[model samples]
Target: MPAVTVSNPLALPRLPEPGLDARPRPVLAVTTAPSGVEGEGFPVRRAFAGVNQSHLDPFIMMDQMGEVDYQAGEPKGTPWHPHRGFETVTYIIDGTFVHQDSHGGGGVITDGDTQWMTAGSGLLHIETPPESLVMSGGLFHGLQLWVNLPASDKMIKPKYQDIRGGSVKLLASEDGGALVRLIAGGIGGYEGPGITHTPITMTHVSVNPGAQVTLPWRSDFNALAYSLAGSGSAGIERRPFHLGQAVVFGDGDSLTIRADEVQDSRSANFEVVLLGGQPIREPVAWYGPFVMNSHRELQQAMEDFQAGRLGTVPTS
Candidate 1:
Protein backbone atom coordinates (compact mmCIF):
# COMPACT_ATOMS: atom_id res chain seq x y z
CA MET A 1 0.00 0.00 0.00
CA PRO A 2 1.18 3.50 -0.83
CA ALA A 3 0.68 6.64 1.22
CA VAL A 4 -2.12 8.82 -0.16
CA THR A 5 -0.80 12.13 -1.42
CA VAL A 6 -2.44 15.23 -0.01
CA SER A 7 -2.34 18.32 -2.20
CA ASN A 8 -1.35 21.61 -0.62
CA PRO A 9 -4.60 23.44 0.08
CA LEU A 10 -3.00 26.85 -0.44
CA ALA A 11 -1.58 25.88 -3.81
CA LEU A 12 -4.89 24.88 -5.39
CA PRO A 13 -5.72 26.91 -8.47
CA ARG A 14 -9.03 28.71 -8.37
CA LEU A 15 -11.74 27.56 -10.75
CA PRO A 16 -11.60 30.19 -13.49
CA GLU A 17 -14.64 32.23 -14.39
CA PRO A 18 -15.04 34.41 -17.49
CA GLY A 19 -16.78 37.20 -15.62
CA LEU A 20 -17.12 38.08 -12.00
CA ASP A 21 -20.42 39.85 -12.55
CA ALA A 22 -21.98 37.02 -14.53
CA ARG A 23 -25.54 36.23 -13.56
CA PRO A 24 -26.10 33.16 -11.48
CA ARG A 25 -27.67 30.15 -13.10
CA PRO A 26 -31.39 29.62 -12.78
CA VAL A 27 -33.13 26.53 -11.44
CA LEU A 28 -34.05 24.35 -14.40
CA ALA A 29 -35.93 21.70 -12.47
CA VAL A 30 -36.28 20.04 -9.09
CA THR A 31 -36.36 16.27 -8.63
CA THR A 32 -38.00 15.05 -5.47
CA ALA A 33 -39.51 11.82 -4.18
CA PRO A 34 -36.69 9.69 -5.51
CA SER A 35 -37.68 6.14 -6.22
CA GLY A 36 -37.08 3.76 -3.33
CA VAL A 37 -35.46 0.45 -4.14
CA GLU A 38 -33.57 -2.30 -2.36
CA GLY A 39 -29.93 -2.48 -3.45
CA GLU A 40 -28.11 -5.78 -2.86
CA GLY A 41 -29.81 -6.08 0.54
CA PHE A 42 -30.13 -2.57 2.00
CA PRO A 43 -32.64 0.11 0.99
CA VAL A 44 -31.73 3.09 -1.18
CA ARG A 45 -33.29 6.21 -2.65
CA ARG A 46 -32.19 6.66 -6.24
CA ALA A 47 -32.16 10.20 -7.60
CA PHE A 48 -31.47 9.17 -11.19
CA ALA A 49 -31.27 5.88 -13.13
CA GLY A 50 -34.72 5.04 -11.93
CA VAL A 51 -37.40 3.58 -14.19
CA ASN A 52 -38.62 7.13 -14.91
CA GLN A 53 -35.19 8.40 -15.99
CA SER A 54 -31.73 7.09 -16.90
CA HIS A 55 -28.23 8.26 -17.71
CA LEU A 56 -27.57 11.90 -16.93
CA ASP A 57 -24.85 11.69 -19.59
CA PRO A 58 -21.40 11.75 -17.88
CA PHE A 59 -23.25 10.50 -14.80
CA ILE A 60 -24.98 7.13 -14.65
CA MET A 61 -26.70 6.87 -11.22
CA MET A 62 -26.90 8.37 -7.72
CA ASP A 63 -28.10 6.52 -4.65
CA GLN A 64 -28.63 7.75 -1.09
CA MET A 65 -28.03 4.80 1.21
CA GLY A 66 -29.50 3.96 4.58
CA GLU A 67 -30.25 7.17 6.54
CA VAL A 68 -32.24 4.50 8.28
CA ASP A 69 -31.98 3.25 11.84
CA TYR A 70 -30.97 -0.35 11.38
CA GLN A 71 -32.03 -2.67 14.15
CA ALA A 72 -29.54 -5.31 15.17
CA GLY A 73 -29.57 -8.35 12.88
CA GLU A 74 -31.22 -6.55 9.95
CA PRO A 75 -30.00 -7.71 6.56
CA LYS A 76 -27.78 -4.95 5.12
CA GLY A 77 -25.21 -4.07 2.43
CA THR A 78 -24.21 -4.88 -1.15
CA PRO A 79 -22.43 -8.16 -1.71
CA TRP A 80 -19.93 -8.98 -4.46
CA HIS A 81 -20.91 -7.41 -7.78
CA PRO A 82 -19.24 -6.71 -11.10
CA HIS A 83 -18.90 -3.34 -12.82
CA ARG A 84 -17.26 -2.12 -15.95
CA GLY A 85 -16.82 0.99 -18.06
CA PHE A 86 -17.60 3.42 -15.21
CA GLU A 87 -16.55 4.81 -11.82
CA THR A 88 -18.22 4.61 -8.44
CA VAL A 89 -17.84 7.43 -5.92
CA THR A 90 -18.87 6.71 -2.34
CA TYR A 91 -18.99 9.49 0.25
CA ILE A 92 -19.64 8.41 3.79
CA ILE A 93 -21.64 10.83 5.89
CA ASP A 94 -22.17 8.61 8.91
CA GLY A 95 -21.31 5.06 9.97
CA THR A 96 -18.49 2.87 8.70
CA PHE A 97 -18.32 0.78 5.53
CA VAL A 98 -15.80 -1.86 4.54
CA HIS A 99 -14.98 -2.30 0.87
CA GLN A 100 -13.13 -5.09 -0.93
CA ASP A 101 -12.43 -5.42 -4.61
CA SER A 102 -11.13 -8.23 -6.82
CA HIS A 103 -7.90 -6.32 -7.39
CA GLY A 104 -6.80 -6.96 -3.78
CA GLY A 105 -7.87 -3.45 -2.70
CA GLY A 106 -9.83 -3.21 0.54
CA GLY A 107 -10.37 -0.64 3.29
CA VAL A 108 -12.85 1.02 5.60
CA ILE A 109 -14.40 4.39 4.87
CA THR A 110 -15.69 6.18 7.94
CA ASP A 111 -17.59 9.42 8.34
CA GLY A 112 -16.49 12.10 5.87
CA ASP A 113 -14.24 9.60 4.06
CA THR A 114 -14.60 8.94 0.33
CA GLN A 115 -13.88 5.95 -1.90
CA TRP A 116 -13.51 6.63 -5.64
CA MET A 117 -13.15 3.39 -7.61
CA THR A 118 -12.81 3.16 -11.35
CA ALA A 119 -14.24 -0.06 -12.71
CA GLY A 120 -12.49 0.50 -15.95
CA SER A 121 -11.92 -2.74 -17.87
CA GLY A 122 -13.81 -4.74 -15.21
CA LEU A 123 -13.80 -5.73 -11.51
CA LEU A 124 -15.77 -7.35 -8.70
CA HIS A 125 -16.34 -5.61 -5.36
CA ILE A 126 -18.37 -5.71 -2.16
CA GLU A 127 -19.45 -2.93 0.21
CA THR A 128 -20.87 -3.74 3.58
CA PRO A 129 -21.18 -2.40 7.12
CA PRO A 130 -18.25 -3.37 9.32
CA GLU A 131 -18.94 -6.24 11.66
CA SER A 132 -18.70 -4.08 14.78
CA LEU A 133 -21.21 -1.52 13.46
CA VAL A 134 -23.62 -4.15 12.28
CA MET A 135 -23.68 -5.83 15.66
CA SER A 136 -24.21 -2.56 17.54
CA GLY A 137 -26.96 -1.35 15.18
CA GLY A 138 -27.10 2.39 14.51
CA LEU A 139 -27.78 5.09 11.98
CA PHE A 140 -26.20 4.71 8.56
CA HIS A 141 -26.17 7.33 5.79
CA GLY A 142 -24.13 8.00 2.70
CA LEU A 143 -24.18 8.72 -1.05
CA GLN A 144 -23.06 6.50 -3.95
CA LEU A 145 -22.65 8.06 -7.38
CA TRP A 146 -21.70 6.47 -10.69
CA VAL A 147 -19.66 8.47 -13.18
CA ASN A 148 -19.30 7.36 -16.79
CA LEU A 149 -16.07 7.27 -18.73
CA PRO A 150 -15.76 8.35 -22.33
CA ALA A 151 -15.67 5.55 -24.87
CA SER A 152 -12.01 6.18 -25.55
CA ASP A 153 -11.04 5.58 -21.88
CA LYS A 154 -13.63 3.05 -20.72
CA MET A 155 -11.05 0.28 -20.49
CA ILE A 156 -7.93 2.25 -19.76
CA LYS A 157 -7.08 0.73 -16.35
CA PRO A 158 -8.46 0.18 -12.89
CA LYS A 159 -7.67 2.64 -10.10
CA TYR A 160 -8.69 3.45 -6.54
CA GLN A 161 -8.67 6.68 -4.53
CA ASP A 162 -9.26 6.33 -0.80
CA ILE A 163 -9.69 9.80 0.64
CA ARG A 164 -9.72 10.28 4.38
CA GLY A 165 -11.83 12.90 6.12
CA GLY A 166 -8.91 15.00 7.38
CA SER A 167 -7.22 15.06 3.99
CA VAL A 168 -10.13 16.79 2.22
CA LYS A 169 -9.61 20.50 1.61
CA LEU A 170 -12.08 22.82 3.30
CA LEU A 171 -12.71 26.35 2.01
CA ALA A 172 -14.59 28.72 4.22
CA SER A 173 -16.68 31.77 3.39
CA GLU A 174 -15.33 35.13 4.55
CA ASP A 175 -18.14 35.52 7.04
CA GLY A 176 -17.36 32.03 8.43
CA GLY A 177 -20.95 30.93 7.98
CA ALA A 178 -20.28 28.52 5.17
CA LEU A 179 -17.72 25.82 4.36
CA VAL A 180 -17.07 23.83 1.19
CA ARG A 181 -15.21 20.54 1.18
CA LEU A 182 -13.60 19.74 -2.14
CA ILE A 183 -13.89 16.03 -2.78
CA ALA A 184 -12.97 15.72 -6.47
CA GLY A 185 -12.75 19.21 -7.99
CA GLY A 186 -11.90 22.85 -7.42
CA ILE A 187 -14.02 25.02 -5.12
CA GLY A 188 -13.12 28.42 -3.75
CA GLY A 189 -9.51 27.97 -4.84
CA TYR A 190 -9.12 24.64 -3.02
CA GLU A 191 -8.78 21.48 -5.09
CA GLY A 192 -9.83 18.03 -3.91
CA PRO A 193 -7.30 15.19 -3.79
CA GLY A 194 -9.08 12.64 -5.97
CA ILE A 195 -7.89 12.50 -9.61
CA THR A 196 -10.78 12.11 -12.04
CA HIS A 197 -10.87 10.64 -15.53
CA THR A 198 -13.69 13.00 -16.47
CA PRO A 199 -13.51 16.68 -15.65
CA ILE A 200 -16.02 17.37 -12.90
CA THR A 201 -16.65 19.21 -9.65
CA MET A 202 -17.81 17.32 -6.59
CA THR A 203 -18.23 19.19 -3.31
CA HIS A 204 -19.94 19.00 0.05
CA VAL A 205 -21.23 22.32 1.37
CA SER A 206 -22.40 23.39 4.81
CA VAL A 207 -24.09 26.73 5.39
CA ASN A 208 -25.21 28.21 8.67
CA PRO A 209 -28.55 29.91 9.08
CA GLY A 210 -29.06 33.06 6.99
CA ALA A 211 -25.65 32.72 5.33
CA GLN A 212 -25.14 32.54 1.57
CA VAL A 213 -22.38 31.58 -0.89
CA THR A 214 -21.98 32.24 -4.59
CA LEU A 215 -19.60 29.95 -6.45
CA PRO A 216 -18.38 30.10 -10.03
CA TRP A 217 -19.07 27.22 -12.40
CA ARG A 218 -18.46 26.42 -16.03
CA SER A 219 -21.42 27.36 -18.18
CA ASP A 220 -20.84 24.50 -20.57
CA PHE A 221 -21.17 21.79 -17.95
CA ASN A 222 -24.33 20.25 -16.50
CA ALA A 223 -24.77 20.98 -12.75
CA LEU A 224 -26.90 19.70 -9.90
CA ALA A 225 -27.21 20.19 -6.14
CA TYR A 226 -28.65 17.60 -3.83
CA SER A 227 -29.93 18.77 -0.44
CA LEU A 228 -28.79 16.32 2.20
CA ALA A 229 -29.97 18.09 5.35
CA GLY A 230 -32.04 21.12 6.38
CA SER A 231 -33.71 23.57 3.94
CA GLY A 232 -32.37 26.25 1.64
CA SER A 233 -32.92 28.32 -1.50
CA ALA A 234 -30.71 27.75 -4.54
CA GLY A 235 -29.84 29.35 -7.89
CA ILE A 236 -31.05 32.75 -9.11
CA GLU A 237 -34.65 31.61 -8.96
CA ARG A 238 -34.32 31.30 -5.18
CA ARG A 239 -36.24 28.10 -5.39
CA PRO A 240 -36.82 26.46 -2.03
CA PHE A 241 -35.26 23.03 -1.60
CA HIS A 242 -35.66 20.58 1.23
CA LEU A 243 -34.09 17.36 2.34
CA GLY A 244 -33.89 14.59 -0.29
CA GLN A 245 -34.48 17.03 -3.17
CA ALA A 246 -32.12 17.45 -6.13
CA VAL A 247 -31.99 20.76 -8.00
CA VAL A 248 -30.74 20.86 -11.60
CA PHE A 249 -29.49 24.18 -12.92
CA GLY A 250 -29.77 25.96 -16.25
CA ASP A 251 -26.89 27.52 -18.17
CA GLY A 252 -24.75 30.09 -16.36
CA ASP A 253 -21.25 30.79 -15.10
CA SER A 254 -22.17 30.62 -11.42
CA LEU A 255 -24.71 29.47 -8.82
CA THR A 256 -25.90 30.87 -5.49
CA ILE A 257 -27.20 29.06 -2.42
CA ARG A 258 -28.57 30.52 0.82
CA ALA A 259 -29.45 28.78 4.02
CA ASP A 260 -32.84 29.57 5.45
CA GLU A 261 -33.60 30.18 9.11
CA VAL A 262 -33.17 27.10 11.21
CA GLN A 263 -36.33 25.56 12.61
CA ASP A 264 -34.50 24.43 15.74
CA SER A 265 -31.05 23.76 17.11
CA ARG A 266 -31.00 20.30 15.61
CA SER A 267 -31.56 21.74 12.14
CA ALA A 268 -29.38 24.81 12.51
CA ASN A 269 -27.43 24.18 9.30
CA PHE A 270 -27.98 23.18 5.69
CA GLU A 271 -25.87 20.67 3.77
CA VAL A 272 -25.74 19.74 0.09
CA VAL A 273 -23.48 18.06 -2.45
CA LEU A 274 -22.84 20.06 -5.63
CA LEU A 275 -21.68 18.26 -8.76
CA GLY A 276 -21.26 18.95 -12.47
CA GLY A 277 -19.41 17.75 -15.54
CA GLN A 278 -19.37 18.13 -19.31
CA PRO A 279 -21.75 15.71 -20.99
CA ILE A 280 -20.19 12.69 -22.71
CA ARG A 281 -22.98 12.81 -25.34
CA GLU A 282 -22.41 9.23 -26.45
CA PRO A 283 -24.60 6.20 -26.94
CA VAL A 284 -25.22 4.17 -23.75
CA ALA A 285 -26.06 0.51 -23.33
CA TRP A 286 -26.50 -0.17 -19.61
CA TYR A 287 -27.39 -3.50 -18.07
CA GLY A 288 -27.06 -4.19 -14.35
CA PRO A 289 -23.58 -3.02 -13.28
CA PHE A 290 -22.09 -2.80 -16.75
CA VAL A 291 -22.40 0.37 -18.83
CA MET A 292 -21.07 0.17 -22.36
CA ASN A 293 -21.60 1.90 -25.70
CA SER A 294 -23.44 -1.01 -27.29
CA HIS A 295 -25.20 -4.28 -26.57
CA ARG A 296 -22.33 -6.32 -27.98
CA GLU A 297 -19.92 -4.72 -25.51
CA LEU A 298 -22.34 -5.40 -22.68
CA GLN A 299 -22.48 -9.05 -23.67
CA GLN A 300 -18.72 -9.21 -23.70
CA ALA A 301 -18.60 -7.78 -20.16
CA MET A 302 -20.85 -10.56 -18.91
CA GLU A 303 -18.74 -13.16 -20.63
CA ASP A 304 -15.58 -11.78 -19.07
CA PHE A 305 -17.12 -11.74 -15.61
CA GLN A 306 -18.36 -15.34 -15.92
CA ALA A 307 -14.95 -16.49 -17.09
CA GLY A 308 -13.24 -15.06 -13.94
CA ARG A 309 -10.98 -12.84 -15.98
CA LEU A 310 -11.74 -9.83 -13.79
CA GLY A 311 -9.61 -11.33 -10.98
CA THR A 312 -10.50 -12.09 -7.35
CA VAL A 313 -9.97 -10.64 -3.88
CA PRO A 314 -7.17 -12.39 -2.00
CA THR A 315 -8.43 -14.35 1.01
CA SER A 316 -5.26 -13.89 2.99
Candidate 2:
Protein backbone atom coordinates (compact mmCIF):
# COMPACT_ATOMS: atom_id res chain seq x y z
CA MET A 1 0.00 0.00 0.00
CA PRO A 2 1.14 3.57 -0.67
CA ALA A 3 0.55 6.58 1.52
CA VAL A 4 -1.90 8.97 -0.03
CA THR A 5 -0.44 12.45 -0.08
CA VAL A 6 -3.07 15.16 -0.31
CA SER A 7 -2.37 17.75 -2.97
CA ASN A 8 -3.58 21.28 -3.29
CA PRO A 9 -6.22 21.89 -5.92
CA LEU A 10 -5.06 23.88 -8.88
CA ALA A 11 -5.88 27.56 -8.54
CA LEU A 12 -6.41 29.65 -11.63
CA PRO A 13 -3.18 31.01 -13.05
CA ARG A 14 -3.53 34.78 -12.82
CA LEU A 15 -3.03 36.50 -16.17
CA PRO A 16 -2.87 40.19 -16.91
CA GLU A 17 -5.36 41.97 -19.13
CA PRO A 18 -5.32 39.85 -22.30
CA GLY A 19 -3.88 42.92 -24.04
CA LEU A 20 -7.48 44.01 -24.73
CA ASP A 21 -7.62 42.02 -27.96
CA ALA A 22 -8.49 38.47 -26.85
CA ARG A 23 -11.69 36.67 -27.72
CA PRO A 24 -14.32 36.66 -24.94
CA ARG A 25 -16.87 34.19 -23.54
CA PRO A 26 -20.48 35.06 -22.81
CA VAL A 27 -21.70 34.70 -19.21
CA LEU A 28 -24.14 31.85 -18.73
CA ALA A 29 -26.08 33.00 -15.71
CA VAL A 30 -26.61 36.37 -14.00
CA THR A 31 -28.23 35.54 -10.68
CA THR A 32 -28.83 37.47 -7.45
CA ALA A 33 -29.61 36.80 -3.76
CA PRO A 34 -31.90 39.46 -2.38
CA SER A 35 -30.98 39.19 1.31
CA GLY A 36 -28.63 37.47 3.73
CA VAL A 37 -26.89 37.89 7.09
CA GLU A 38 -24.32 40.65 7.56
CA GLY A 39 -22.60 38.77 10.35
CA GLU A 40 -23.34 37.58 13.91
CA GLY A 41 -25.26 40.77 14.56
CA PHE A 42 -27.35 42.89 12.20
CA PRO A 43 -30.86 41.79 11.32
CA VAL A 44 -31.37 40.19 7.94
CA ARG A 45 -31.27 43.01 5.44
CA ARG A 46 -30.49 43.54 1.78
CA ALA A 47 -26.86 42.68 2.18
CA PHE A 48 -24.87 41.62 -0.86
CA ALA A 49 -23.13 38.83 0.97
CA GLY A 50 -21.68 36.70 -1.84
CA VAL A 51 -23.54 33.73 -0.32
CA ASN A 52 -26.20 33.43 -2.97
CA GLN A 53 -23.91 33.64 -5.97
CA SER A 54 -20.63 32.28 -7.08
CA HIS A 55 -18.94 29.15 -5.86
CA LEU A 56 -16.95 28.89 -9.06
CA ASP A 57 -13.71 29.16 -7.20
CA PRO A 58 -12.46 28.43 -3.71
CA PHE A 59 -14.21 31.60 -2.59
CA ILE A 60 -16.68 30.19 -0.09
CA MET A 61 -18.53 32.94 1.75
CA MET A 62 -18.78 36.74 1.37
CA ASP A 63 -20.38 39.18 3.80
CA GLN A 64 -20.50 42.90 3.00
CA MET A 65 -21.97 44.84 5.92
CA GLY A 66 -22.39 48.56 6.29
CA GLU A 67 -24.19 50.82 8.76
CA VAL A 68 -22.07 49.14 11.38
CA ASP A 69 -22.55 51.39 14.36
CA TYR A 70 -19.04 52.00 15.65
CA GLN A 71 -19.84 54.15 18.62
CA ALA A 72 -16.87 54.74 20.92
CA GLY A 73 -18.15 52.60 23.82
CA GLU A 74 -20.55 50.27 22.09
CA PRO A 75 -19.36 47.15 20.32
CA LYS A 76 -21.22 45.52 17.46
CA GLY A 77 -19.93 42.14 16.32
CA THR A 78 -19.50 38.43 16.86
CA PRO A 79 -18.27 37.27 20.22
CA TRP A 80 -15.62 34.67 21.02
CA HIS A 81 -15.98 31.98 18.40
CA PRO A 82 -14.04 29.18 16.78
CA HIS A 83 -13.13 28.52 13.17
CA ARG A 84 -11.41 25.57 11.57
CA GLY A 85 -10.84 24.27 8.08
CA PHE A 86 -10.81 27.78 6.62
CA GLU A 87 -9.56 31.36 6.95
CA THR A 88 -11.51 34.58 7.25
CA VAL A 89 -10.30 37.80 5.62
CA THR A 90 -11.70 41.13 6.72
CA TYR A 91 -11.30 44.53 5.04
CA ILE A 92 -12.51 47.70 6.72
CA ILE A 93 -13.96 50.25 4.35
CA ASP A 94 -15.54 52.94 6.50
CA GLY A 95 -14.90 52.22 10.21
CA THR A 96 -12.35 50.37 12.28
CA PHE A 97 -12.45 46.90 13.84
CA VAL A 98 -10.80 45.90 17.10
CA HIS A 99 -9.46 42.37 16.72
CA GLN A 100 -8.26 40.08 19.49
CA ASP A 101 -7.06 36.51 19.39
CA SER A 102 -5.87 33.53 21.36
CA HIS A 103 -2.38 34.06 19.96
CA GLY A 104 -1.57 37.24 21.94
CA GLY A 105 -2.32 39.46 18.92
CA GLY A 106 -4.74 42.36 19.01
CA GLY A 107 -5.15 45.62 17.13
CA VAL A 108 -7.51 48.31 15.94
CA ILE A 109 -8.16 47.87 12.23
CA THR A 110 -9.12 51.14 10.64
CA ASP A 111 -10.54 51.77 7.23
CA GLY A 112 -8.41 50.03 4.57
CA ASP A 113 -6.85 47.67 7.06
CA THR A 114 -6.76 44.02 5.96
CA GLN A 115 -6.73 41.10 8.39
CA TRP A 116 -6.16 37.61 7.09
CA MET A 117 -6.76 34.96 9.75
CA THR A 118 -5.83 31.39 9.00
CA ALA A 119 -7.82 29.03 11.18
CA GLY A 120 -6.04 25.88 10.31
CA SER A 121 -6.09 23.51 13.24
CA GLY A 122 -8.62 25.72 14.96
CA LEU A 123 -8.92 29.19 16.48
CA LEU A 124 -10.95 30.98 19.13
CA HIS A 125 -11.18 34.76 18.97
CA ILE A 126 -13.38 37.80 19.44
CA GLU A 127 -13.86 40.52 16.85
CA THR A 128 -15.29 44.00 17.48
CA PRO A 129 -15.54 46.16 20.63
CA PRO A 130 -13.08 48.77 21.91
CA GLU A 131 -14.33 50.43 18.77
CA SER A 132 -11.70 51.27 16.17
CA LEU A 133 -14.18 53.43 14.33
CA VAL A 134 -16.21 56.40 15.54
CA MET A 135 -18.81 57.89 13.24
CA SER A 136 -22.41 58.64 12.39
CA GLY A 137 -24.40 56.59 9.93
CA GLY A 138 -23.49 56.43 6.26
CA LEU A 139 -21.80 53.49 4.60
CA PHE A 140 -19.77 51.57 7.14
CA HIS A 141 -19.06 49.05 4.46
CA GLY A 142 -16.54 46.20 4.50
CA LEU A 143 -16.07 42.65 3.28
CA GLN A 144 -15.65 39.21 4.92
CA LEU A 145 -14.32 36.23 3.02
CA TRP A 146 -13.73 32.59 3.92
CA VAL A 147 -10.90 30.71 2.27
CA ASN A 148 -11.00 26.92 2.41
CA LEU A 149 -8.05 24.93 3.70
CA PRO A 150 -6.87 21.70 2.20
CA ALA A 151 -7.16 18.60 4.38
CA SER A 152 -3.43 18.20 4.77
CA ASP A 153 -3.11 21.81 5.96
CA LYS A 154 -6.20 21.83 8.13
CA MET A 155 -4.15 21.45 11.27
CA ILE A 156 -1.47 23.94 10.27
CA LYS A 157 -0.52 26.80 12.55
CA PRO A 158 -2.91 29.71 12.67
CA LYS A 159 -1.68 33.06 11.36
CA TYR A 160 -2.83 36.65 11.03
CA GLN A 161 -1.93 39.68 8.88
CA ASP A 162 -2.73 43.35 9.06
CA ILE A 163 -2.15 44.83 5.61
CA ARG A 164 -3.02 48.52 5.62
CA GLY A 165 -4.86 49.98 2.64
CA GLY A 166 -2.00 52.33 1.84
CA SER A 167 0.43 49.43 1.98
CA VAL A 168 -1.45 47.64 -0.81
CA LYS A 169 -0.44 48.69 -4.31
CA LEU A 170 -3.05 50.50 -6.32
CA LEU A 171 -2.67 50.92 -10.09
CA ALA A 172 -4.84 53.20 -12.16
CA SER A 173 -5.45 53.58 -15.84
CA GLU A 174 -5.94 56.78 -17.85
CA ASP A 175 -9.59 55.83 -17.96
CA GLY A 176 -11.79 54.62 -15.09
CA GLY A 177 -10.24 51.22 -14.38
CA ALA A 178 -8.03 50.60 -11.35
CA LEU A 179 -6.82 47.70 -9.17
CA VAL A 180 -6.28 47.93 -5.41
CA ARG A 181 -4.84 44.94 -3.70
CA LEU A 182 -3.32 41.48 -3.21
CA ILE A 183 -4.35 40.70 0.31
CA ALA A 184 -3.06 37.27 -0.55
CA GLY A 185 -1.80 35.13 -3.41
CA GLY A 186 0.01 36.70 -6.37
CA ILE A 187 -1.01 38.57 -9.45
CA GLY A 188 2.46 38.26 -11.08
CA GLY A 189 2.25 41.16 -13.55
CA TYR A 190 0.76 43.38 -10.83
CA GLU A 191 2.95 43.77 -7.78
CA GLY A 192 0.39 43.31 -5.00
CA PRO A 193 1.14 43.16 -1.28
CA GLY A 194 0.25 40.48 1.28
CA ILE A 195 0.88 36.74 0.96
CA THR A 196 -1.23 33.66 1.72
CA HIS A 197 -0.57 30.22 3.13
CA THR A 198 -2.33 28.52 0.25
CA PRO A 199 -3.06 29.17 -3.40
CA ILE A 200 -5.46 32.08 -3.84
CA THR A 201 -5.84 35.65 -5.12
CA MET A 202 -8.17 38.42 -3.97
CA THR A 203 -8.27 41.79 -5.68
CA HIS A 204 -10.59 44.70 -6.26
CA VAL A 205 -11.01 46.11 -9.74
CA SER A 206 -13.04 48.55 -11.76
CA VAL A 207 -14.09 48.22 -15.39
CA ASN A 208 -14.55 51.59 -17.09
CA PRO A 209 -17.89 52.40 -18.64
CA GLY A 210 -18.37 50.85 -22.08
CA ALA A 211 -14.70 49.94 -22.00
CA GLN A 212 -13.85 46.30 -22.37
CA VAL A 213 -11.05 44.61 -20.40
CA THR A 214 -9.89 41.12 -21.20
CA LEU A 215 -8.37 39.00 -18.43
CA PRO A 216 -6.28 35.91 -19.11
CA TRP A 217 -6.84 32.94 -16.81
CA ARG A 218 -5.81 29.32 -16.53
CA SER A 219 -8.08 26.49 -17.53
CA ASP A 220 -7.57 24.68 -14.25
CA PHE A 221 -8.09 27.58 -11.86
CA ASN A 222 -11.55 28.56 -10.63
CA ALA A 223 -12.60 32.21 -11.17
CA LEU A 224 -15.50 34.36 -10.06
CA ALA A 225 -16.43 38.05 -9.81
CA TYR A 226 -18.56 39.88 -7.25
CA SER A 227 -20.59 43.01 -8.03
CA LEU A 228 -19.67 45.23 -5.16
CA ALA A 229 -20.19 48.94 -5.78
CA GLY A 230 -21.59 49.42 -9.27
CA SER A 231 -23.46 47.64 -12.02
CA GLY A 232 -21.38 45.95 -14.71
CA SER A 233 -21.08 43.20 -17.30
CA ALA A 234 -19.09 40.02 -16.54
CA GLY A 235 -18.84 36.19 -16.66
CA ILE A 236 -18.04 33.72 -19.42
CA GLU A 237 -21.60 33.97 -20.75
CA ARG A 238 -21.20 37.77 -20.73
CA ARG A 239 -24.69 38.48 -19.42
CA PRO A 240 -25.71 41.39 -17.20
CA PHE A 241 -24.66 41.26 -13.52
CA HIS A 242 -26.16 43.93 -11.34
CA LEU A 243 -25.10 45.19 -7.93
CA GLY A 244 -25.07 42.74 -5.00
CA GLN A 245 -24.45 39.72 -7.15
CA ALA A 246 -21.61 37.39 -8.11
CA VAL A 247 -20.98 35.41 -11.28
CA VAL A 248 -19.08 32.12 -11.14
CA PHE A 249 -17.37 31.38 -14.42
CA GLY A 250 -17.48 27.86 -15.75
CA ASP A 251 -14.32 25.82 -16.10
CA GLY A 252 -13.33 25.13 -19.67
CA ASP A 253 -10.23 25.08 -21.79
CA SER A 254 -10.51 28.86 -22.21
CA LEU A 255 -10.64 31.67 -19.65
CA THR A 256 -11.75 34.97 -21.17
CA ILE A 257 -13.58 38.07 -19.94
CA ARG A 258 -15.00 41.19 -21.56
CA ALA A 259 -16.76 43.76 -19.39
CA ASP A 260 -18.32 47.10 -20.32
CA GLU A 261 -19.80 49.47 -17.79
CA VAL A 262 -23.58 49.80 -17.83
CA GLN A 263 -25.10 53.01 -19.13
CA ASP A 264 -26.23 54.10 -15.67
CA SER A 265 -22.81 53.30 -14.31
CA ARG A 266 -20.84 54.90 -17.14
CA SER A 267 -19.85 57.66 -14.73
CA ALA A 268 -19.98 55.38 -11.75
CA ASN A 269 -17.27 53.40 -10.09
CA PHE A 270 -17.94 49.85 -11.18
CA GLU A 271 -16.53 48.01 -8.22
CA VAL A 272 -16.14 44.22 -8.13
CA VAL A 273 -14.26 41.50 -6.27
CA LEU A 274 -11.92 39.44 -8.37
CA LEU A 275 -11.09 36.08 -6.80
CA GLY A 276 -9.65 32.78 -8.03
CA GLY A 277 -8.20 29.72 -6.42
CA GLN A 278 -7.94 25.93 -6.33
CA PRO A 279 -10.95 24.14 -4.89
CA ILE A 280 -10.65 21.90 -1.83
CA ARG A 281 -13.70 19.79 -2.54
CA GLU A 282 -13.24 17.85 0.64
CA PRO A 283 -16.18 17.30 2.93
CA VAL A 284 -16.86 20.23 5.27
CA ALA A 285 -18.48 20.00 8.69
CA TRP A 286 -19.58 23.52 9.55
CA TYR A 287 -21.11 24.63 12.80
CA GLY A 288 -22.27 28.04 14.02
CA PRO A 289 -18.77 29.49 14.18
CA PHE A 290 -16.47 26.59 13.59
CA VAL A 291 -15.80 24.37 10.59
CA MET A 292 -14.11 21.00 10.62
CA ASN A 293 -14.13 17.81 8.61
CA SER A 294 -16.48 15.88 10.84
CA HIS A 295 -18.76 16.26 13.84
CA ARG A 296 -16.16 14.62 16.04
CA GLU A 297 -13.51 17.16 15.07
CA LEU A 298 -15.89 20.02 15.69
CA GLN A 299 -16.70 18.56 19.08
CA GLN A 300 -13.01 18.45 19.92
CA ALA A 301 -12.69 22.14 19.03
CA MET A 302 -15.47 23.05 21.43
CA GLU A 303 -14.07 20.80 24.10
CA ASP A 304 -10.65 22.39 23.72
CA PHE A 305 -12.14 25.82 24.26
CA GLN A 306 -14.01 24.69 27.35
CA ALA A 307 -11.01 22.80 28.78
CA GLY A 308 -8.68 25.73 27.98
CA ARG A 309 -6.18 23.48 26.12
CA LEU A 310 -6.53 25.48 22.91
CA GLY A 311 -3.94 27.99 24.08
CA THR A 312 -4.52 31.13 21.97
CA VAL A 313 -5.33 34.75 22.87
CA PRO A 314 -7.36 37.25 20.93
CA THR A 315 -5.25 40.26 21.93
CA SER A 316 -3.17 41.31 19.01
> lDDT per prediction?
0.78, 0.60
Tell me the tens digit of each residue's lDDT in model 2 across 73-173. 44466767667777888877656677777776657776667888887876677776343333333235577787777678878888888788777655443
Q: Which structure among the candidates has the greatest lDDT? A: 1
lDDT of 1 by residue, 1-316 (tens): 0011223423433334336678688887777846575556687777653322332568887888867778886637886889999999999888888998888876899888899999999999988888888788877778899999999988977889999988887776555566678888775456788889988889887777888878888776778888777889998668998777888887888888888887332435788789988788888889999999999999999999999988765675
lDDT of 1 at 190: 65
Give the per-residue Cα lDDT of candidate 2 at 136. Answer: 38
TM-score of each: 0.89, 0.78
